[model samples]
Target: MATHMTSKKIQNRMKRRVALNKGMSGIFLLATSFGVFILGVLFYQILTEGIPYINLEFLTGKLSTNPDRAGIMGAILGTLWLMAVVIPVTIILGVGTAIYNELYAKQGKLQSIIQTNISNLSGVPSIVYGILGMTIFANMLNLGSVVLAGGLTMSLLVLPIVIVSSQEALRAVPGYLSEASIGLGATKWQTIKNIILPAALPGILTGSILALSRAIGETAPLVVLGIPALLLPFPGGLFDRFTVLPMQIYYWTLDASLVGEYQFLASATIIVLLIMLFILNGTAIVIRNKFQRRY
Candidate 1:
């Protein structure tokens, strides 16, 4: 009788535990669904405003006083140019910094200090970067307020993000690979270049996407760095005065006179930005899947 009672009590306890777990899981699912629903609503709103306005002419045409003739060609080209310069510079600087921090430096106070500063910098506001760029890259260096100046300033804002991401990727590479390469008579540089880096390439590319997407969307940094109020035609080079879509929208939105026309333009531009982000994120996913299949 006593043994039977004990078993019955244990069974009841287990049932209660399962019920509690199920209730908690339902709550979690409800919360997650609410978040996804909110995101869906935002996407729907942007799409409704943006999709109908997008046309080939709008994409290729120059800025104009007439609404029907207006397009984003110059702004689009400027953004592309900014990305071309910023992306490569950031990859080199950020990856190099990560390699130095992870592989070369011993865990010392100096390393800790460097690490601390980098961490703090990632949290620094983009506007602060604009100020720094204007003071140093623009004034002191005399690069002036141009595409190159803006690109350099934007690069600084994103540098810490890349370093953090690159370091994580590098850290994920197995230590044994480094040891084996060294044992096979490879130098530290050789080991990193050939063995560890190749293994970490997928992760690095994934992180690069994150940084690039952010740079593509950022407006205030460039604006504060003195992106021109207008560039009706596409630029010839980095030094040529230029504007980007975000700055274009920002300029137009604030103009009480042109708000009705520019508001529609801004909506259309935001849609393009979203599409670009989708492509970038999709590319990252494809790369990740391909690498997984191969490796």
Candidate 2:
């Protein structure tokens, strides 16, 4: 009888455990389904409202106060020019900092402080970087609100993300590969360049592209930098004052209440921005798949 009672208690405990597990699983599934449903609704609205406005004229024309005549070509060119500055600056500085921190920096108080600050900076609001840029790059440095200033501001905003991601990718490389290279009489720099970098390339590229995706979408920094919205010539180089897709979307959305057609234009710009992000992320995925190593 005592043995029977113990078995019954054990079964009851197991049943409760199973019930809890199933309950949590159901909750997670429900949450995921809710998020996906919301995203589907948003995409549906954007597609329905924006598709009619995406003609060649819309894509190629210059910005105008007249909504019908307005085009996003200048904005597109400006965005591209901004990226020209951001990509190289972020990759070189971010990757270089990561390499120094992970491979060369002696682990100590200074390194710990630096790492902690970088991690914290990654969480800093984009607007703060904008303010910093406005103060230093725009005002103090007299760079004005040109493409170069905006690009550098965006670079500062995303730099910590790139550095942190690069560090993580560097860490993911297997130690054995480096050990083997060193055993083969490879210098430290030689091993890093030949073995470590190639092995970690997939993760690094994925992270950098993701960071850049954020940079391209951010409106707050550019807005704070006072980037113009309309009637601007195409940005030919970094020194020219410019606008980007986000800025256009922002101004159009604001003007939408006055003119309903501006809403559709804003939606169209959002679509283009989404397409650009998709292209970037798709390239990252392709590169990652081609170079990804199991070990």
Candidate 3:
């Protein structure tokens, strides 16, 4: 009788624990569903208001004082020029820094300090980078609010992210690969170049591309650097004045409160911006998946 009572008590306790866990899981699911529902509603609203306004004329024409005639051609060209500068600079510097730290730097206080600073920088506000860019690139270097200055500023903001991600990717490579390369009479640089980099390329590409995507969407830094939303000419060079899709959307959204029709224009521009982001993110996903499968 005593043994039976003990087993029954244990079974009751286990049942209660399971019930509690199920209740907590149900609550979490409800919360997640609510958030998704809200996002779905917002996307539906944007699609409804923006789709009708998007046309070839809206895409290829220049911004105008008249709402019906406004377009984002200049903004699109400017954004592309900015990316041309940002992509090369960020990849070179970010990957180089990661390689040095992970593959060459000796473990010490200096390395720790560098690592800490890089991590801290990842959390710094975007507007702060803009100020730094304004003072250094704009005022000191006389780059002004041109494409080069904007691109450089955005690169700085995303540099830390790239470095951290690259480092993680580099560290993920198997130690045996490097050992084998060395055993085969390869130099340190040769091992890294021939074996490590190819193995790590997928992670590096995914991280860097994601960072660039974030840079392209940033508005605060550009605003601080004084990018105007009214660039009439298409950006033909890095030195030319430029404005990006986010800036145009921002200016139009503000104007929408007064003109009303500008809201539809803003929505249409947002559609284009979303498409650009989707393409970039999709590319990253594909590359990441391909490398994962191969490796």
lDDT of each: 0.84, 0.95, 0.94
Q: Give the TM-score of candidate 1.
A: 0.88
Reference-based TM-score of each model: 0.88, 0.97, 0.94
Model 3: what TM-score?
0.94
Q: Identify the runs in model 1 with alpha carbons over 4 angstroms from their true place.
A: 1-28, 255-258, 293-295
**Of candidates 3 and 1, the better by lDDT:** 3
Best by TM-score: 2
After TM-score superposition, the amount by which residue 280's alpha carbon in candidate 1 deviates from its true location, in angstroms, is 1.7
Which clashing pairs does model 2 show? Answer: none
State the lDDT of candidate 1 residue by residue for 1-295, as single tens digits: 9999999999999999999999999999999999999999977876787677799999998987666577888888888888877988999999999999998899999999999999899999888988998899889989886789888888998999999888998888888889999999999999999988888887887888888888888887887777875644688798877888778777766752654766677778888777788999888888776764232
lDDT of 3 at 138: 95
**Tens-digit lDDT track of model 2 for 49-157:** 9999999999999999899988999989998999999999999999999999999999999999999999999999999999999999999999999999999999999
Off by over 4 Å in 3: 1-17, 293-295
